[model samples]
Target chain A: MPSDLPHSHGRRQFLKLGSSGLAVALIPVSAFAETDDMLAAQAELFGDRPVQTGRVSVDLPPIAENGFSVPINIQVDSPMTEDDYVSQIVILSPRNPLPVLAQYHLTPRNGLAAVSARIRLGGTQSIRVIAEMNDGTLWSGEKETLVTLAACVVL
Target chain B: MTTIRLSVPDTAERDEIIQIRAMIQHDMESGFRVGARGEFLPRDIITRFECFYNGDQVFAADFHPGVAANPFLEFHVRATDSGSFEFVWTDQHGEVWTDTASIQVS
Candidate 1:
């Protein structure tokens, strides 16, 4: 028996089988793994609708000595009327483990489309505010600050 | 547990922005680390906050883990009537705390 033809043919078969096996092995392991779980939830709220910039503002101290109790305020431009008004205001932090910090729901009866609160930060990061209107439009604003005392640092 | 104070002015003018203030004592852990154990503490968060006028919800918020501990939120709201105003905070663990004060329209 000539070894040339059998070896060539067998080599082709081995290469094909090896490559296909590699592809199959990679699929399930990758499927079960997740780099970021919070990203999915964050994207679900902000993915389809491109967040518009402006008409809302987030205020924070330029430098915060205490990350445990940093004051934050979100103000959105709205008439606060029954006919047309802001439906909700949401606060998001880009670097926080749970990014969406706080949210306020408003109606015409409330008469104010602003919310004030204190937030904890792990480090220096940008805080975002997304104001959702009754008509289904989202307006965004951001503020950056330095955190001298990082929140979440265990030891 | 600590006493939380909430106040709305007695002679708050209508349509005229009136100051509202709240102060609460809480451990607002940053969930980053624990001092003694040298381990990351699980995130504990306040999920909702509400302010009521005459027993009606006037302002509300759904808070997250980023909120600092012992939070105090102050803002302005128009006083439409003479009644008691209430402030309430609910944590993610289902703990609820509240404070109230009377408001009089002048």
Candidate 2:
């Protein structure tokens, strides 16, 4: 009976170890890892051009009660004239499953380089908006939102 | 056929800045969800939206899955002339939904 008890104890231990290993693999990777991948994908679109951090303003609540529909407004201080205007505006959410949320293409016909929409966020993360001027200059703005409830959770 | 709604001032002063709003009805399936039977749902979303004023593009957007369903967009456009504003939305399947609104400028 004593020899049989030892064999049962060893089997139990092996099962426990296997279950723990599976748990670790099931856990999602840290948000930072996802952000790095998103950044690399962004670089492919805009190149390694230095992103100037001004001339654009991002408006959003500091704390979002719901991540499913967070209202966002972006405004660029451009005159929207033929000589100088914003050609493109991009919104990126690093933590979201798809980082590039929206890309807006504007022309001088748009009297203002401003847009407003509702976007989804996976969690507390930084939202970046980049404005590309017709002169080939890029300007960006960033805002952080603490999401109490995440939207894109895998069931 | 999908129902589309567009909001623009029927009349405006010349060169006045007018707000343009458009909404389309569609499910923006993010392609990340699994069905009850454990089958992956393919992504189907409106990938592009374009607004043309008097045959010239005034604004456009490239949308991803992060955007919510029934996409709504608001932006500013200079009312230069009284012409038809054409709005077009293209989905992943190459299907296009279009609507037009006319504006009068004094």
Candidate 3:
């Protein structure tokens, strides 16, 4: 938070602003500004590795009646052998308050490379899925969801 | 205190793949809700979950506020031997909720 932000003001400083400033302070700061967290997440993880678009897919309802708990199924095409297995999978929501939803670490002991869970969606946005193989190869996939009732937003 | 629900196969064949499910009772407050007094609520949620097979970690997940409340997980594990599977979850405040299940392999 920047020092100029109203919420950073101390009680003494807030009192100095009087009634008009008090009202402004009461208004909570919200992230109305759009952010490209999807790109940010990829940069943080894979860096410059070219994200190949295949070998991974996500199953999600085309129209989410509610965004509170949208079910998502993730699949990765891997042999799950000791030599070549999916080591990690990162889920990202481009429009969510936090881009990185979760990172699942898998071992060859998993036998298969798939996961299912109910994840939250703030609104309509693309869900990005990235899989990292044991050998450092990265595969990617994406799907868009239409959220009727948005979550993670307050005005 | 928090309650945890775990689903592990009671029995399996050696080297067989088995599915495991775990759920935690939590509010998963995303910190985006505005209170009646018009203040934003602070985010409180489980930040991590790990599954250990016979004391060796086999699967783990790093969670964020984007996950739904009362987070549930479903994944697979190879039944290599008869042992115990321990599931543990840690919240942002460092509170932990854990449970264990035993499986038989023949």
Candidate 4:
């Protein structure tokens, strides 16, 4: 699939290294003042590919009375073998100050590419999941949720 | 750090579903207001959590700052075995906290 941003797609090839090492490229909040640069950086690392629709499933409660700890589950259909497998899974919150919340790297030894966790949301927004196959194919899924009580502020 | 409680059902009437409940104590700071003269409090939020059963992770999520303080989550597990389950939580500051609970089969 073709990437929406051509320049950003090329940057992803430079990042096929260690998954943990990619965290170093994440821009800090201070840099958010330059939203354009931040977007460019994010697109380079994340948006460079066309994410196939409906390849992954994300499950969450429809109405989260509280936001501090909302349950979430993600599962991808893959054989997960030594030769072909899911390399990474990324969770994105569109409205959060930092959209990229978590990234999980899996090897064939992991047995399954499914994960369940609790997440904090600032408000009601859409949560997006992007799954990257070992071959650089990106698949996406999204869900919109309503949160009653939000957390994560310094008061 | 607030106390956390987790419970797994003792037995399941069916083969596909098992109930699990989890609770944590915390005053999720919203970072919206200040104390006395307006001293901005520190932000202490759990950003992500995962559940591992028998070394295989069955659930995981990425949390944001908007979640309320002291969250409780409940869900079902596809009854596989009466093994141990582990929950790992990571706060906004990148600190990791973990708890373990075991399930018994009838």
Q: Among these predicted structures, which one has the highest DockQ?
A: 2
- Find the candidate with the highest TM-score and give its number: 2
Question: Between 1 and 3, whose TM-score is larger?
Answer: 3
lDDT (0-100) at residue B15 of candidate 3?
Answer: 94
Each model's backbone clash number: 4, 0, 0, 24
Give me candidate 4's TM-score against the actual structure.
0.54
lDDT of 1 by residue, B1-106 (tens): 5879776777876776676778778766556656566667776766777888888887777766677777777665767888888888887789998888887786
Worst 10 residues of 2 chain A by lDDT: A24-33
Residue-level lDDT of model 4, residues B59-96, one tens digit each, is 66554444445655554456667778898887777877
- Model 4 / residue B25 / CA error / Å: 8.0
Rank the models by DockQ, top first.
2, 1, 3, 4
Give the per-residue lDDT of model 4 (tens digit) for A104-143: 6655544566766667776677788788888988887888
Every candidate's DockQ is: 0.54, 0.59, 0.53, 0.22
Q: CA lDDT, every prediction?
A: 0.76, 0.90, 0.89, 0.68
Which model is ahead, 1 or 4, in terms of DockQ?
Answer: 1
Measured with C-alpha atoms, the lDDT of residue A126 in candidate 4 is: 72
Q: Highest lDDT: which candidate?
A: 2
Q: TM-scores for all candidates?
A: 0.77, 0.86, 0.85, 0.54
RMSD of each: 7.4, 7.7, 11.9, 13.3
